[model samples]
Target: MFELTRYDGRRRIRGSIYLSIGLSLLAAMVIWVYPSFEAEVDLDQLLAAYPEPILQVMGVRTMASLGGFLSFELYTFGWIILLGLYLAYATAGTIADDVDRGRMDVVLAMPISRSRVVGERFAAMAVPIVGANLLPPIVVYVGARLIGHPIGAADVLAVHLLSIPYLFACAGIGLFASVIFDRAAIAQRVALGVTFALFLSESLLTGTDAEAIGAIAPMRYYDPNAVLIDGSYDLVGAGILLAMTVSFLVAAQLWFQRIDIS
Candidate 1:
């Protein structure tokens, strides 16, 4: 059995702090500024400006108001950076770095299985990840409450909930790459490349020609704005993401079992 997080005595405390600060800044941007109170922008015009087909690709839908501020708006940025790319770099590097730094042999000889080792690494990285993902909505909630424009509790929760599956998918994929590749950089690029491609495929699925096929991508688990602003959760979409996350996690465990420590 394995948990992806544990406290090593020489923990990277600074690394975690940096992640928190970055997430805080992102929350400030999404909840406090731009569409919240600063810009007072129109939703319809923004939607109309972007082509209908293009809208589907970005995981955005017509919210008609600040409702657009919910799921999709946060996702528009979070998915690309937080979900799609960041964890890939973070997770893929952990084990591979151990191997490169001549620490893999030492760690593997401990009273632990390979699966547990990889899982612990993932959990450690996930500390900041969950923190980063959870911050935006928290910021939105606080700012909205303070500014007298409170977003619903459900709506705020939906954003964080919706993000988990998306982020976990990338996490699993990164674990796969980390086990397969020897170099962190290579694992990261491959992980990012594949995940982004899947995201785009999910995006491009908006068209009739590709719609039939693009649904295969895990990105379909979200309709960002709908869940973010309307408090609507796509049950089927969440189920699909959960399945993918589990599948990826299982795969990572099985795959890492065969990894050679020598």
Candidate 2:
């Protein structure tokens, strides 16, 4: 069981780290290339064009805002897409892959109970997300600090931490989907599709009565600007993220037990 856990976790961590490496490098490059941290032209004018309620929900205040940019640009309200993609790939196929690829029979011959097997495997899948949540900021921070901008470390680290809830939310969604379907492909699609819809809907409803859609997107609650630039952390939203992870994990266990796995 321990071995399986390590195996699963390593696979997930490696793949996610590789995927995020290029993006993190590019972000660091751009941050260094810019003469000023702030964008050109008057950001205030662009900010004024936006609706007040939407701005409040997004926790955005200025045009040259790092908070708004992290939530809006890096996460793009589509962070769920990447998060789900990683989770779906890592988890949706865990059990299905073992069975389809003829590893399940061999594993069952070991001393592990069914529940332990499922639990360990699920844990393995989470390792990658933890790595995903951790690594990129290191790359970005190292680059930023090398350019004589010590604060870039805090900037990248903050936004990446803000992503904690977003990424775990995606992982949970995938875990639940993994328990729901028999096929890895179907599970992946279900998890990714649900996450995509949640975030995409929130973005589309940015300034309307439907703006409440954002509350459903865990990514929306994280104001990267406050943490990254303003240096303030969101304890309340962080609590929600932790709670959501627990909930999804519980749901995955329940459903996995209720269903049959061959």
Candidate 3:
């Protein structure tokens, strides 16, 4: 299991490091520009001008502070969409690529059980996701302090910490897609499509009577703007996100175990 996990981890480490650096730099840039926005316009008014759906989708409530700005500019789109999409794409190839290349047959011929194989590969998928989540908060926090708009350390930590479960859930979705499809390209496309669709569903359904439907989407439980800006921590929401992650992973494991890899 450790060897399998390490194999997957090694495959992803270089790309994960590059992605982490890029995202951290973006977070820093967003934080560094907060003072310019504060000096130039009424952030509350600017953000309020957008429609509720747009605001909800963008995760922009109030840009009146550093936390809010970072939440809107960095965390919402950058973390949720860009990073989430990357993780999903990467995970979608975890099993499908090996299977498609005939590498899975060699592995299955060994002593490893199908469940352990799937679980270890899933663990490999998680290495990059967790690394991607870690560096941004430090960058955001240090940048905020450097610019004289010090966001609370706890708030920054909470935002990044809570994001782990959300990203994990997204990866789980991709993992399911990976096992369901034999081709990596098809699995990637399916994972990306489903992940983005869920995000849109959660965003667009915010105020409707059908909002209950959005509960199925993972983003419904993740509110970086509320957590980072308003210091609101939703333990129930975090729990739900974690539950979804486990459910998706378990489903993927069972499917992989039962399906014909040929």
Candidate 4:
């Protein structure tokens, strides 16, 4: 099981490293610009020009300081949309690519049970997600300190720590799609589309008559802005996200175990 996890994790390390570096740089850039915004713009007034719904969607409840700015501009969209899409894209190929290329047959013929294969592969998918989530907070923290903004350690920690379950849930959805589709590209597209659609639905449906519909989305529970800016960490929401992650992975495992890999 460890070997299987290692093998799959090694395959994804290069891409994961690149993604982490890119996100770190982006965080630094966002942090670097905070002083300029403070010097030039009245953030409250600037944010007030936008509609309330637009502000909510953008995760901009407050922009008075660096934590608020980083939460609004960097973590909310970058972590949610870009990181979510990347994880889905990466996990979508975990099984589908192997099956599509006839590699799954080789893997299955190794005396391993189908359950172990699926479970270990999904475990491997977590490497990149965890790696991608870690580096950005360090960059954001360092950058904030350098600029003298010095965001609260707890707030910075909360934003990245809570993100783990959110990304896992997104990847679990991709894993499910990967098992359903034989073609890697098709699986990836479906995963990406569904991930984005969930986010869109959450953004559009929240605070409406059908807000419960949006509650089905993982994004509905994740609010980096709330964690970082308002200092509000939703432990229950994190638990729900984690529960959804497990549910999706269990569904993928069960389905993959019963399916004919050949």
lDDT of each: 0.68, 0.65, 0.86, 0.87
- Give per-residue CA lDDT, model 4, range 129-203, as digits (tens): 888877888888778889998888888888888998899999988989999998999999999999999988898
Ranking by TM-score: 3, 4, 1, 2
Model 3 CA deviation exceeding 4 Å by range: none
TM-score of each: 0.83, 0.77, 0.96, 0.95
What digit string (tens of lDDT, one per residue) describes model 1 on residues 36-66?
4435657667678887777766666654544
Per-residue lDDT for 141-249 in model 3, tens only? 8888888988889988999888888898899889999999999999999999999999998888888998999999988888888888679998898899889988988
RMSD in Å for candidate 3, one decimal? 1.2
Q: Which ten residues in a row have the lowest lDDT in candidate 3?
A: 52-61
Error of 3 at 125 (Å): 2.0
Report the C-alpha lDDT of model 2 over 131-246, residue by residue, as the tens digit: 66565677556654675555555666666776666677667777777767777778777877777676667656777898876777766666666666678778788778778877
What TM-score does candidate 3 get on C-alpha atoms? 0.96
